[model samples]
Target: MVAFASLKCIIISSLLLPSEAFAPQSNLVNKKVSESSTSLAGVGKVVNRVKDSLLSKERSREDLKIGIAGFYDRSSQIWEEVWGEHMHHGYYVPEDRTDHVQAQIDLIDEVLKWAGVPEPTGDNKDELPKKCVDVGCGIGGSSRHIAKKYGCTANGITLSPYQAGRGNELAKEQGVDDLCSFQVADALEQPFEDNTFDLIWSLESGEHMPDKEKFVNELFRVATPGGRIIIVTWCHRDLEEGEEGLTKKEEKLLAKINRAYYLPRWCSVDDYVRILKENGAVDIKREDWSYIIAPFWKAVIKSSLNLKSLVGLLKSGFSTQRGAYAMFLMLRGFNKGLIKFGLITCTKPKE
Candidate 1:
């Protein structure tokens, strides 16, 4: 029955939805409603209920929460050191650098390009910003890039106040301060007027949202008529329910990821697209970049083992146990084929 439902849901979702399925609402109260609506809508309601009954009790484990916090705390320290910013995933290093570090940064640049962010110029606002919002703007690397490359004003928001502060500092240093600003804001309840941003860029942040539809809808609402939203996120494979619960391997993998990485939940690329379309986005385009992004987690695991980095991490007062937990989760997620790295772009219609 579970497998049949998973397959059925996949077919319905894939055939219809866009990517903004995880997007949120206008303010605080309605935010919850939007979230509930998106999750409970159509097939999602069934999936959510089943998942909750099976996993909700374990979802709030203290040890898991602590581990995730440590994971963020440790990684943020390393990011600040490397890029003079607080980005969690990777950085944009120019193509001309001579070192291994520079080469890796170049790879990040490629990902950004692949993700559709144009190369940064000294003057960005003129090119990129008809209106823009950078979701989860860790350390402001990409946000600054958006402002500099497009020469348009941008509002970069993050759940982590630390990330926002660091992003603002870097933006100021890079002289894109006037065009780019950072705010400590929830992606689920963005603090912007409707129809404000022309471009919304969410880099690997959608996984953290518990109520997926609200998050996507909020992005849609802020987008000016005919504006665009781009999402590059970590996701899980489409489920195929069988005799037991949710493929034991897959369930374990998702639980591990959620426990270690602070992600509220993970969903399939097809489901993501469905929610977006249902929420009113049109002409959605999606591409799975899992093959290219698969190695990023490998690199993260490697970085977690650096002795010098470990020393800093220790001094930073984070838990090595939690770091281990996160790495282990990443490994499990990859091995089980439960996580996917994907990209989506869509345009809101002009009213």
Candidate 2:
């Protein structure tokens, strides 16, 4: 295990810019609803009683941070080689579009459009954000794209030093080094002043947060009043009224995913809406984007089967290999409706 203290020090040092750390009191609470005593409930009870379960559990944030950082540190090169720069899922328009790179870029574009961020025109420089921050940025792909598209200064924060370094190299190579930068930082304890960024973005990073409430709060805390925030993440299905929670099979499958990906837990899309509301965000909208992103795993599975990808996976480490295999598990989960792709957009109210 990576030493927690050492990792914390490394993250703090890698922040690059000096700012006071915001420490919000955690208001995380777990609530369970009572099950109805009906025939359907009896059937659900029988299902739960028959099988062992491995539902989401609390994990040490320090350990989780270390594990995730190490995983990305090792696997980033392999991903860059096999999947290009974007580490998140793609958005399919026609449901059959197969150009992987363009699809990933379109995912970003779609997200921006959903958030009502306008396309950059040379005439209207004032319409774009002056500053932006990307939480859990992987190799700064989204960061570079935002800088190039909007002519905005973007700061991308990740847990992996390798990702941060490589992202900086890419920014320099793309001639956006001055406008875009990358750093190793913690999402729960970001190193930035309150209300610093005009836009805050998090793509598929929420599941890795050990403290989801704190993660959401930090995003809101760093955004300037009226700043836009967009998040895309993996979510599980929300329980219906009086329905029992995840089935044993679903729990076991999620456990495999958690182990493979270093994720702390998966929440429902409704959970995110509640978190955003609790954090005082307004103009909130949530979209179930499961179908659009479902094709991404299939593409990844196909890409992973190639000779170059296999060699890279082997050289990366055991964790990468495990995660690569887990792609099939994710595909199964998606097919079974056990996993969902959720997108949320909101804004901090102007003070």
Candidate 3:
């Protein structure tokens, strides 16, 4: 077994430092360029050329989507065996800092609390959601949680057939089969009627979307008027007007992370805010939970050393093994402030 005690000590010690120490350097170049006007114009052309080159080199969206499904199909069992049902990060409480499982559960609760989702009670049928949809539901953990908590009927969609089957099995096991269901469906083209769901919940799925505009529109299409939409995902830092975009180093790092995780690309939280606003969503709010969720990678890294996880990682083949290695990259990215854990909530305008 991994030396969990020593690992915990190291992670806890590192996390105690001031948050500013983790902030990445800004890419804004404040100095004025003294080159000739012709030279400046040429430089702009060269920059555009480089940007186009990078865009052309990105993986095809269809291939990436297929790859992501395969990645999860192969690795789902490993995740379930090691990290429990919730496939996302955890929230650590200073007072109740006990084990990883409870911390993960607490993270789910924290996300709901941050999104201002009221706790459901048997008496609040009118107040609670009647229909919910979990876009990118991983093994139906969040779907089951919502269904049981609010007595709502939930539908979960994922690209992986294995995950869909497993999620249904889990729902049956938890005695929520009637309340929740899972199916293989694409988020970009969700198989649901417009205004179908009272709540649309997406957790850690936004990163996989290659066409973010289409993704957001799909969410809106499936949601009822005044329906609550909550999204939690990875985001990059926002770029200011007149400031340069990501540096070459940052781009290269992100490219590597994307390949390992089967993600298309990452957008800034501000980008998401703008899209939500343009889509006519109201009460738009955002929170950066990066600091709170920073400790998750450490816990996952330590857990990977367990014999069961090691065996599973090996059995799952190269992609899953690479993903395990990428955990270190995520840790570094968070520490450098290049990666952000973001939460955004909005409501469709009541017509």
**lDDT tens per residue, model 1, 1-351:** 000011111222221223343234224323543444432243344333333433433455345334333444345644455434424333223322234344334544565465455565666634444667888676676777656656778888865566677778878888888898988777778999999998888877777667789889888989988787888777777656553335766776676546435556567777789988897788788876656544444343434432233223323322332333344445456566666667788878888
lDDT of 2: 0.72
TM-score of candidate 3 relative to the true fold: 0.81
In the range 158-195, model 2's lDDT, one tens digit per residue, is 89999899999999999999999999999999999999
Query: How does each model score on lDDT?
Result: 0.57, 0.72, 0.72
The 10 consecutive residues of candidate 1 with the worst lDDT sum are 1-10
Using lDDT as the measure, name the better of candidate 1 and candidate 3: 3
User: Against the correct fold, how does model 1 do in TM-score?
Assistant: 0.69
TM-scores of the candidates are 0.69, 0.81, 0.81
lDDT (10s digit) by residue, model 3, range 44-77 = 3432443343333568888888887887776676
lDDT of 1: 0.57
